[model samples]
Target: MAFWRSTSLFSSSTPSTTTINDNTINQETIERLCDRLQLATRIEDRRDALRDLKGYSKKCKLEVGTKSMILLADILQGDRTDLDLIQLALETLSNIMTYEVDNNDEQPNLPQDITIQFTELFIKNKEHVHAALDLIEETDFNIRRTSIKFLTILLTNCTKTLQDIILESGPMGVSKLVDLLQDEREVIRNDALLLLQILTRSNANIQKIVAFENGFERLFEILISEGGSDGGVIVEDCLSVLLNLLKNNPSNQSYFRESSFIRRLVDCFALNSIGEKHWLKQKETNINLFLQVIRILVSPTNSNQNIVACQRSISQCGKKKIES
Candidate 1:
């Protein structure tokens, strides 16, 4: 989420800014904010502290590192009625959890030690992960969306640990994520695709659960809805998730074949034009991912019948894309 602020140079009655916006925030300020977050009796004070912390986190990664994760998680797990507070905490946690280490000279990237510490602290307690999953059940799209972003960061930093927790949360955890695929908001839907793709990359259990949750079917439905190859990066993102599911897992591969998704897969290859200019990088990438899915299904490891069936599906395809 992009942060936007409006400033009035002539106004004198504005609220005092706790976090210095220009320079890297100091550890003293972070500790003060965490103290407020931990001890604040009223929801308004907690929100004020979290708002300042969220602002500080965007610029000073190490100062804010892992200091308030426990406090934030407490708010998430304990507070149900304050949607604004939950959203602020999630956003602040996301900023603190950001793992990308930029080499920019203006602001030094977080050291390796801090990054590992952040990941370990969050995963050490299973409730933190559970609290994150619970926030998604909230009806507010902003909270749900921020929760997804926080989970994405967590999953990226600690893939193995987070994957285990998510799987242990039962089918409900992964199911809620799959439901995001059908979100009426495109941004939410796209973020869910990326999250599921990362979540299912190496975990066969998650891949199976997602596949059972109609992962393949919904992905194909989204593909058609986005205009197949005529769509943008979303088309490639959808194929990437499909490829992960079908890649090495025999069960998912068999599911793809049995579900008659092979017909749908081949239909995506029918582009408006095959000429060089017509094939934008994104379309070519989508088509390339499509071939990968097909290859996985028809690999020698799969049954000979499955290979023949997939081959037949492709051979029978015409120029026109299949209607969903």
Candidate 2:
């Protein structure tokens, strides 16, 4: 099946074309469109220009085509202004983002504005956020993984917006994002971890959002689960985020400390004895992460018995390493 079809970007039936008379277009109009397309800076202006460019493309006007080509060349130049142009370009490109153009297809040369537009939209909009999420659900695992990576870049640029969208999507989006921690794509997993990191920055209400959906247990399972070789980087990131959340919520800390979750986290670094040999190659990284967890667990600000238990776990792990 076609990728776009899976994403539902196009209709099942072929779209009918409405022809425009080329002779009605002139040089001046093309130059004006070019100028409007070039001057687009903010989200609104870029969106307008993209709509106009689509119309121009549909009209088959040579002058409009020339203007679009010039704009696309300027965009692909990798100018410092590329970020500003991403949203506009993305909106226009959404017209084509999921489609595979033929080798000899007469594809319009997208401007810097258009390229930036897509990048920006990917960074800003909640709808685009959902699209990125759905991409993770694709039948092709690579596409699912790539979607997460793309989301990471977007989250880096639009932290507030990313948080807002995640919050708005509520438990469902949170669950999907957490599930991605076990995905085959390392980058996607890393992005999901980063996203959780950002979300934890919100007040207790947002941190509580995780518990509303049983996210804590799901996260623990990922850390302790066996099939996470591709997710080591992400696992480390997830641990960092989890530590932050646990530190912030006294109730959560007390609950996990009593339930064996804390011990299980330390056991995650327990050499080949943990039952997963594939993790050996990543032992050093995992050990460093283990140390970080122990430091957080033993911090003076934490409760007494929990700190002692964490210290014991750390010492045991070190002794086991020495014995080996």
Candidate 3:
């Protein structure tokens, strides 16, 4: 949050441009971390370097983080077989990506050379970046979890530069994240759902990914999944994502219908509607989210059968809620 740049960096005509000046405090920390990381011959040494690298990333802030990140990227680009090292590197990347989006320390009137080149290197070269992207598929839960967490943070907080870089990276980046819904871990699946929600909320060139052949099916699986207990994270996140995907997107709406998501929804509601009227009381928030999804799916042009099915679900919900 401290400012080291001079007053002249702020030109009246250039309000949008900001730059990261080379400061001794930030630069020194970055240099030390880089040296430790490069000279890491022992497992403990690498771990310490990764640990300090993460700390320096934060301490250096925007521009300093950029320089530290360039070195960080170089370390990761090497063939890193050590799982802990990989996790640490991925986490550091996540922190760096996050720093790119923080505006609190931004000096808007300055030149933006360091930050610009910093971002350009990561985006322009796809091969160097794939090492982090490949970690999403690791069977190791911790690595996969870190990768997923990193990705969701990137998509949610980063500006268009990162988004464009991701989308432009083609199937390796965004597509890989989308494919995690089928992951065995419920936590990972929900994390993927969170990512989809961000993409939906942002509407950043996500039409193709949403309309993928199995995308609807995967989301539908989450909708009816009984994986989690009454917290209803699966149901809550799926509805948010489905609503976002279907809103103002007629093609996806049609796809939703074609994919039998409505039928599955009705079945899920009915499945949850049995025995006592008190059953629905515990899942009030979930039912509301489900109902909201139904609201989004219903259109004036829908066929009568679809309407009847929807109404049946709504009526079933209502009946289930009434005290017997």
Tens-digit lDDT track for model 2 on 186-257? 566666677677666644655666654565676777676633323455566667677666765766665666
For candidate 1, write residues 69-107 as lDDT tens digits: 778778888887899998988887777766445634213
Better structure of 1 and 2 per lDDT: 1
For each candidate in the order shown, give its overall lDDT on alpha carbons: 0.78, 0.55, 0.63
What lDDT score goes with residue 300 in model 2?
Answer: 88
Instruction: Answer with 1 or 3, whichever has the higher TM-score.
Output: 1
Tell me the deviation in Å of residue 323 in model 1: 16
- Per-residue error (Å), model 1, residue 114: 2.2
Per-candidate clashes, comma-separated = 0, 17, 0
Best by TM-score: 1
- Give the 10-residue window scoring lowest on summed lDDT in candidate 1: 1-10
lDDT of 3 at 225: 68
Candidate with the greatest lDDT versus the true structure:
1
RMSD in angstroms, all models?
8.1, 14.2, 7.1
Q: What is the lDDT of residue 253 in candidate 3?
A: 63
Error of 3 at 231 (Å): 5.4
Tell me the tens digit of each residue's lDDT in model 3 across 23-95: 5455666677677777767878878877877765544545445545656666566746677877777777765
True lDDT of residue 60, candidate 1: 66
